[model samples]
Target: MEKNNRTIVNAWCMYDWANSVHALVIISSIFPVYFSATALGASGTPDTNFFGLQIKSSVLFSYTVSVSFLITASLVPLCTAIADFTGKKKRFMQFFCYTGAISCMLLYFFTKDTLIPSVFLFGLSLIGWSGSIVFYDSYLPEIATEDKFDAYSARGFSLGYLGSVLLLLFNLSMILAPQFYGITEKSVPARISFLTVGLWWILFAQIPFHYLPAGKKKEKRDGNWLFNGFLELKKVYGRLKEQPYLAKFLSAFFIYTMGLRTVMYVATIFGATELKLPSQSLIITVLLIQLVGIAGSYIFAWLSGQIGNIYALMIGVAIWIGICAGAYHTTEAREFDIIACTVGMVMGGIQSLSRSTYAKLIPENVTDTASYFSFYDVTEKLAIVLGTFIYGAVEQMTGSMRNSILALLVIFIIGLLLLYRIPSRKVYHLKLDHREN
Candidate 1:
């Protein structure tokens, strides 16, 4: 790979800006509240039956996210592996990105009459959004040198935060002041917000699609693409065992990500259910997080430069432990707001540093970058399944989300310990095939 080019790097980062609208509006903030209000009615609790089982709205949403992760975890590796074999990662990324954006647009049609369709589209969009991320991340190594990964990764996340916040602010205006848009009902504005996310995603994605370089080399087509892809992935898995440093990093990543992802996905619901916050407060809190996150990503990136990525990540994890504790004790809206601000500061830092740290750990001269990132993404999605499951199960068993939040402390601690086991200097070596080089 050549040295980093400014245009390509900017283009790559813009995808983060593009897709993050979906993350904020559809995944983390708006959709959850809107869907709960719509489906469960004014009680804000789940009274609806799914497959003959009565479930709470929060539990139902968590399980829906788990199912989406399950499907993505099962399928993304194979898809990424096939893309690597064919050297068409860009095409694969485009497919997932467009699919996800269109799915967001489809959410406009969802209502009480079409609950099943809503759930299906929500899951589909999640899959599309997350699946595209695998290939998007793979481009990092290709676009920038290892030494620059931290800054580039942080820039991408910061841009994402800023872009999403801008859109969410507009969406909030529409929801909070519907008369300004000539809308009479809240539901109409909420549905229109979903449509805006899809349009924004599709429009901004074109910049990256146009500017990102194509795969440098192409593998010859064998009659058996699926079989070849699996064989290739099996070989990569075998090779991964020889890289102890990378392997340990991945272990820590998987564990910590469980806590990280669960918090990102469920914190809004927790605020609504446990803190008894209204929609306005929850949306505002989410906006604050995004605003704070822009600084968090940059600050953490700088912190990584000062103390190293590993130590910076450890600090971020420590803050998460504190946040979990605070969440357990929070009863007032003010207490929750303080915790939300803390979460915002650490969330972007941990996520940005983790990506750069992993990028630095990857073996030099590796060819199947997409497949490598597929393994990374699959680890993350599976962790999400485990984390969301534990969260939902704890709530069901204990009859309180407080316990569920506290349970994350164990995961964070375990991840910290695992991270400690990794050597400060990169020690693992991987030999590349000449064909791959």
Candidate 2:
């Protein structure tokens, strides 16, 4: 278990490459627009009946995303606790990887007539994509030394941006020029793009599954695993309370990430709906973001090395506040692209730094890394739930996404205040054992 082992670090990082295709193509870019267009019909804001209440298609889409994150947040801790107890984190990761990949492929069958099934599969795929990351991120403390955490984490995100951008470029070509591929309908190419994401994810995931080491198996215990898992989670919660710095960091992370995740998830839709940008412009703008994000991840990592993680994170938060304000005022396509580029610069930095910062703060003696990261992941997922719900509610009531974007400013300000209170001394001088295996 040598620190900064090349094989282990590369294998671990490759998982980001595999999964980020889904993050870009399905979650962030193409599929949301496709879903809205398909589900809402020609009117662009059709009413739908859910259980007993009627709601707008756009609002329903946001609520569906919230529900998916809510389910993942509730379930992942127990699942990770079981993985930690059994020493089977790799197996759990593999299960989600396969589940999510298959779900992405199933999206090829989605149609306007199959709204319920389409939404179900979309949520399932999101669960698979996001749920696997808890264990994948937990591997960071095991694979790299403390000093290398920020760079290693940033490298993973950089690779993800590069890899996903390549696939998206190909998919964009197919969607934009269907005649070259002998496809008659526009939706046909889009469906094929979904299949490409599925295959790419599963095929690349083999690298991590083959090379990332599985730690020693735990001793078999005499108890119901479900009950044992809950007990284990309860113990971790108590331990988290004892680490006040980590607790405060997680609170700030939860608040800011609420705004961050919502913006990332919905930005493309916002452009299409509120700004009335063409599909071609939206796709091109996303490509620009991905290209810029590769540099953004590296820049923020270097900045963290020079100025410290807290300051770099605060800089990112400040940029996000500006992006939200800009989105509210920008109506022209050129202005929107500028805002998108600004988003590109800060998105990867904030996300990558947050992960590395948390990795640095965790207790080294702790054996159950998956359980610890499960709590971290839960904070993020719960934030997504709250952020998306609030955004959707505001849009639904006011009938304008402008107000929804502005509301995120409040969340960002609160997060910035919380982040300022975190003592810098606690994070910078950690002396951790590098012999984790």
Candidate 3:
């Protein structure tokens, strides 16, 4: 395998570094709490029940997320396919990355009273973040040798964790240092922190923009581009049926990713609502997870070298089951740290390894990377829909985060079993012909 593209490879990985901050800061960290408590702040008192739901706010959160998933599912693959056909994966990436970053910058306007523009910005940011990932992921196989794929894939995740930690640290400093730093919650520094995330994402992302080689573009349909994009997607749907291992991998990916996503979306909310932890403490714990996550990503990358990618993935899923089960028995903040540490270890590896594995398995079809990876993108989105709502419903019914966490083990277990049923040797053996294109 040729191995001289370090600059290009690292640049590609840094896109994860750039974009994941938005995921950590905007989507995962500040925005959820902001939306729940501040953005949707009612004037005097709020209704406890709406449409037969007691947790009206949580229900709204769940509904908004569901709709986001549907839109992303329908659109993302086509977006990916267009990138593939036009050989514009890089261009598509720049377009969406900026869309997401600009949206994060706009979040500063969302104070107590203004909500719609804020929500709209957040939603568009979600779309941009997700849309960009479709092509960002498709670039994996193009830039790496077979022997290097797992480590390099894991590298992206590791860098992403580091990026998240940097932004989180800066944000934490702003919130904690109002007196010493001349920053206050009601003033510009707090708002500047939000703007900083957008700047971080956009500026650092230009590294990849400069280094990576352009993907090959095929001539699209002779007809209209919109109609052509639809036809290309249908072609992709047919192609998926032709590839058995790819289909199997995707199915397993969907189930396990659902469990992973459920843990991500609900863990903090559970900590704050059920364990009675303060917001400041909950935020600190999450930042700690990001720091620990940097170590975890490299650990799994090394482990995969010794044990192989499939077995490493199995180890990750096994850890998820334990993390969920452990949450059931936890009664204190100390216990929360244990579960959070377990998550930090497995989350990066599972995502990175799964992606590299798929990159290995995809057939040497010319100009179908986006269209194919779109299945990957949409399945990832649907996982959020299934997991969040299921977790929310279980919590609503039992009125216990403990039961909800325990139930998530079923998804991890089933996905693990399905993953084991796939032929591991085939993954390592997959090859592409340079002659195909």
Candidate 4:
């Protein structure tokens, strides 16, 4: 295999910039809340009361996402394996990205008091969005030099944050100028803004498809693609047993990633439910996080360069702890400012470092990068299960998301402790001898 150079690395990083618009708009900022309050099947005026719980639109959106994550968890690894066997990571990425964009565009068709279509579209979009990311993530080693893994990974995340910001600015413009843009109503502007993401995602996603190289196609190793995919998973499991430190790092990452995912997924929801903030406020808050995230990525990248990956990751974990604690204790809108501050500071660092760290652990010559990343995907999917299940259980039993927020402390603390036990320097020296195709 040829060594990856700087140009390839930058191209790979740009893929993040392309797809992140979908994440920022459909997943994080505008659509979820819209889906809850207006998109789906609800009676006249769109009932806010469901199952004796009266919560904000975003919290309902979070609940729906938790449900979708539960389903996606069960299926992504198998899908990943198939993509690997077919040697079509880039193609598969394109397929899913198109589906997600189409799903996002479908949001515009959702009418008042008819949310079923929107809900379905949201779920489909989530699946397509997340599934494509597994393949996108697997391509990191193909584009990054071993020594520059951290820098490249951080670059991807930084570009992604910037991309999200640009889209958000456009969205904010559409929203503010709805009347000028032919939107004559209150929520129509936001709905139209949601449609823009699908367009942006599809347009920008072409860059990688047009420019970045895909790994070579591979013949099926032992059986049919799906069957062989299943077999590949078992082999991965066996490999994990021999790599206990990597396994341990994975275990720690799984938990903390879950906590991070849950906090981000539910932050806007929690604020709307607990703080009773309006939609406009939520938009402003998310914009603030996006801006802060840009600064945060560079800060952590520089910090990691000075102190090492472990130190940078620990800083992120510490901020997470602070975020959970702040959420648990705050009673006013100002508290959201605290939560946003911590999240903006740490989210990119944690994700970028985790991906690069795992890239280091994996051998350079692994043929089925998509299949191999299936293990990584499983951990990520399972993290959602653990975090959401625990959060939902606590919230239902205690009747407060505050208690749920506090519960994440366990995930962070324990994951951090386990992370401390891994010897990064030793793992970094491991040979990359697995080259079978």
- lDDT (CA) for every model shown? 0.87, 0.88, 0.76, 0.75
Determine which window of 10 residues in candidate 1 has minimal summed lDDT: 426-435
- When 3 and 4 are scored with lDDT, the better candidate is 3
Point out the worst 10-residue segment of candidate 3 by lDDT. 39-48
Q: How well is each residue in 1-437 modelled by candidate 3, as lDDT tens digits?
A: 13438888899899999998877776556556555555332552222333344454444555556666677777775677677777877888889889888987887787655555666677777777877888788777677766777888888998998988888888878776766677556545556666888889899989998887667788655776667667766776677788887888888889999889778766776776668676677778888888788888888878877766777788899999888888888889998987887888788878888888887777754446677677777889988888877877786677676777777989999989988877765344443333344
Of candidates 4 and 2, the better by lDDT = 2
Q: What is the lDDT of residue 250 in candidate 3?
A: 84
List, residue by residue over 179-287, the lDDT tens digit for candidate 4.
Answer: 6677777777777776887888888887778767755766647666667667777888788887786688788899898799888777766766667677667877888
Candidate 2 clashing pairs, residues 3+ apart or interchain: none
Model 2 alpha-carbon drift over 4 Å, by segment: 42-53, 426-437
lDDT of 2 by residue, 1-437 (tens): 78798988998899999999998999778987887677774455556655546777778778888999999988887888788877788899999899889999999988877778888888899899989898899899988888899999999999999999999999999998899999997688888988999999999999999988765467787788778777776777788778988988999999999999999888988888888788878888999999999999999999988778888898899889888888899999999999999999999999999999999889989778788888899889999999999999999999998999989988998888999988664344442323331
- Candidate 3 residue spans exceeding 4 A from truth: 1-4, 39-55, 186-190, 365-367, 396-399, 426-437
Evaluation by TM-score, superior candidate among 1 and 3: 1
Sort by TM-score, best first: 2, 1, 4, 3
Better of 1 and 4 by TM-score: 1
**Which portions of model 4 show Cα errors greater than 4 Å?**
39-60, 426-437
| Superposition error at 6 for model 2 (Å) | 0.7
lDDT of 1 by residue, 19-82 (tens): 9999899977899888777667335456565666778778888888999999988888778877
lDDT of 3: 0.76
